[model samples]
Target: MDLTVIWAAIIALGLFMYIALDGFDLGIGIIFPFFPDDSERDLMMHSVAPVWDGNETWLVLGGAALYGAFPAVYSIVLSSLYLPISFMLVCLIFRGVSFEVRGKANRTKNLWNLSFILGSAGATFFQGVVLGAYLQGIPVKNGVFFGDAFFWVTPFSFFTGMGLLITYSLLGASFLVIKTEGDLQRRMHGLIWPLTLVLIGFILVVTLWTPMTDPHAASRWFDSPARFLLYPVPILVIVVATFMFNAMRHQHDSMAFLLTIILVFLGYIGLLFSIWPYAIPGAITLWDAAAPRSSQVFLLVGAVVIIPIIIAYTTAGYWIFRGKAEASTHY
Candidate 1:
């Protein structure tokens, strides 16, 4: 068996899980300003409070897996992107603290609310910057990151940062549609179509921009035989977007959220296809960056035992907390 491929799959699964689970909660913070009423904010926080912290487990799993399974890529990427990565971590710290303190504070609730918004937006923006920087290809030579710290601060990276903000806001809104009712649900439902339109616009920009600027990506999309397989992704995205629009129009709450998830998945697939086989895009293949075979075997054993347990508990948490959030509930 190719342990490198297996490990790569595991890391991909872990990252996608993180995006799917944690994206909405961080998104709640991004859209917090839209619903300025304190009570409505309470309900929004309550909807995600139970599972929000747990949603980050996949992030931990993904980072650890990368360190163990592909140490070279981990070290090089982290070192090169340290500034944005550090900023993202700091923002998450503020966001997590606000999540806990806002529920209890009587007078300082507004302060915490501000903290939450800044934290979420900062973390998400930097995440998109990091992603864009990675996609544009890290500067590497002889297995080391050779670029200066500000290499990630380009226009494309900032555009990606803004794009992620919209994406997560949409996720947050659709999730609220699932977890609230009455005026809050109505407002969220109202926001869905506009957010979807905005998201589609960002998607179109990225689709065109990536190929226009990156020769490798352009070749992958236009020249490779794999293009045949890749062609269905955008079509599926359109189909999913259409379904999501209809679901929102008809007020199919659960279906809207599910379709939104599908929309995100299709986008994720496109990204993976764009960077297939390359851990550092043009620089390094997964096999070239993979850790020793013995190390992977050991890590695989632990991952096998741990991943299922995490899945079981995460599933239980969601199931137990299912249904519309109550204003009286505090979490």
Candidate 2:
């Protein structure tokens, strides 16, 4: 493969890792608002306490890979997404800080709790909004950005944000089904069934509207392949997800959680395949936006070295932390 292609694959892999790891936490954040009680919320947070930050490393790696491998696409995305991007980062920051401050500040526990929910909600919403904007094709002007900030945050985009949150939350709850025990685990699976149905509804609505909104996507679904023939992917996803969900219901924790991870990972791969070559969804082809080969090759060396380290540390950390969930005790 060419340098650009090779590096793009690497970045794609990093993105996959990010979605599989940090995605559950982000999904948890998205579902936080729906949590009814304080202890339940603490238990929810506890499910991710062992590895949330580590999961975020994939995000960092993806961002770094973008900067190093495709400077043009990176610039365009940043310029076009400045507002939503800032909002997302602020949400991450507040959510993270609240994790610490919530435990220590006796009087301000409620304040920090609210902050955590706000941060999580705000971040999750904008992330979905950003994806919607990208899928819808951002308005790229001259070399510099000129569009208004609200240009990307439409009703459709907002709905997409909600959809992503729900989807991820279901994934996270399914995760807790395996990672946790007792009443908490039982309760989490109860949420997953209804949540999965709701997520399916979201997918239905989005898929139905996608053709009218973005014709390019329709070509992929319609013109590219016979719908019946392409059923295997989703069929497998459903069957496997059903098996995992059922396994969790029966308290088969490891199989349930691992399958849940595979479900999310496979779904991510599908999305990536859907958006191949187009970094900005019809705005620019991956090849067109790729950086210099020389630059990519040089960076690949460092990436080749550091990526493994990141993976090793991340893997080792999770293996060490693997166990039943406990009440979140503030970081």
The candidate that achieves the highest lDDT relative to the unseen native structure:
1
Tell me how far the alpha carbon of residue 226 in candidate 1 is from the true structure, in angstroms, after superposition: 1.2
Residue 112 lDDT in candidate 1:
99
Clash pairs, model 2 backbone: none
Q: Please give the lDDT score at residue 41 for candidate 2.
A: 77
- Which is the leading candidate under TM-score? 1
> Per-residue error at 306 for model 2, in Å?
1.2
The 10 consecutive residues of candidate 1 with the worst lDDT sum are 255-264
How much lDDT does each candidate structure score?
0.92, 0.76
Please provide TM-scores, in order, for all candidate models, with all chains considered together: 0.99, 0.90
Off by over 4 Å in 1: none
Please provide, for model 1 over 20-75, each residue's C-alpha lDDT reduced to its tens digit, 9 standing for 90 to 100.
88999999999999899999999999999999999999999999999999999999
